[model samples]
Target: MGFESVPSLPLEGLETVDAARRPVPASPGTTTTPGAADRAALRTDSARANGAATASPAPPDLKVVPLPVRRAEPGRDTPAAGRSSIIVLLQQVQEQHGYLPRPEVVRCAGEAGISVAQAYGVASFYNFFKLTPPGQHTIRICQGTACHVQGAQGLLERVQSELGIQPGETTPDGLFSLETVACLGACSMSPAVVIDGEVFGRVTSRQVPRILARYRRRK
Candidate 1:
């Protein structure tokens, strides 16, 4: 089954807790809703300051994730980490892991001093974030004007037949997920298909089988 859509959240800034014993202060314009974990992070910080034992931060081997841009709405709060900062964090997580896990969302939200609801909201608002696990290969077909003129229709059909899945759907084997994009900003490469970020321009129906074969072998 397809993933459930993410819920909407208040556009708010990240939450900040004092590393020192100072009560966790919410930076101006930041909305703070202290969760049990947030309180725990604070306790951990205090313990470490007082020479009590605490687990070291997660290893540096953490993955990079790609996050979405925060749209500035009238009611949105500005986080101390700022919108750009959170987006950068999300991007780093996605880049390293290929998908954003719920804990990462909570971690990122906590780091930003934002609530889990806000973090999940931001992650879900953009198409870039994959709350659900994705296939090994992500196939993006261009539906842009130039591509459309250059026989993207045929390419789409070929993709459907080859993968036995439509756009926005993943293969039964979970090897690939097909997506239609308006523009990949590669107008010169109209009728293009991107398999795992490698663009194949001027794709034709004849080439679809070969391309599918190429990806299927990786499975």
Candidate 2:
């Protein structure tokens, strides 16, 4: 089955949360960036925090994650940790763990002085928060007016067949994920797909298999 299209979210600054009991904060703007390597580190942290070990060829070892340098805007002061609101704290959690893992949510809820239900409510209210871990690759198919008229849905089906997973689903091996966006704003390039931050415009369904193979070979 094909996946329904949803609106796309632009990259923006994550909100802050009220600090209590030393709530752990997220690294700055880590969630929405093109820094794949950095995201990989956060995924590692998230996996470890959730007590799930990534089955890799090498034996797992304790590692230290280097913190990114915090940059200040020209005039605006960044919200200080503990002074920010719940949104920012949730952003931190998502940044650290890829998505808001249930256990971390409970912990943050307790620290934020809110119930677990309230926390889930807040997380659900925002389209930005993902409740589950994403695949190693995130593929966004454009289903905007132009793309749809240009046969974007067919492209989506081709991807579905190639991955054997529908949109909003990750492959069983956790290698690829599919999602449909209302528009990528690349109207000129009607049939468009973005794989792992690389935009392939004017894409055709025939190209889907080759594109997926390239990614598979990459990592």
lDDT values for all models: 0.73, 0.72
- Model 1 per-residue lDDT tens digits across residues 1-219: 123454554344433343334465668986555564586677678778989676444213233344455543323445533444456678889988877888897777766666778777677677777776678899999888899999998899988998888776677788998888888878898888899988899999999989988988988
Worst 10 residues of 1 by lDDT: 58-67
lDDT of 1 at 72: 36
lDDT of 2 at 2: 32
Model 1 residue runs over 4 Å out of place are 1-85, 161-169, 182-189, 197-199
Candidate 2 yields a Cα-based lDDT of 0.72
TM-scores of all candidate predictions against the true structure: 0.52, 0.56
Which regions of candidate 2 are displaced past 4 Å? 1-85
Q: What value of lDDT does candidate 1 attain over all alpha carbons?
A: 0.73
Candidate 2 TM-score, true structure as reference: 0.56
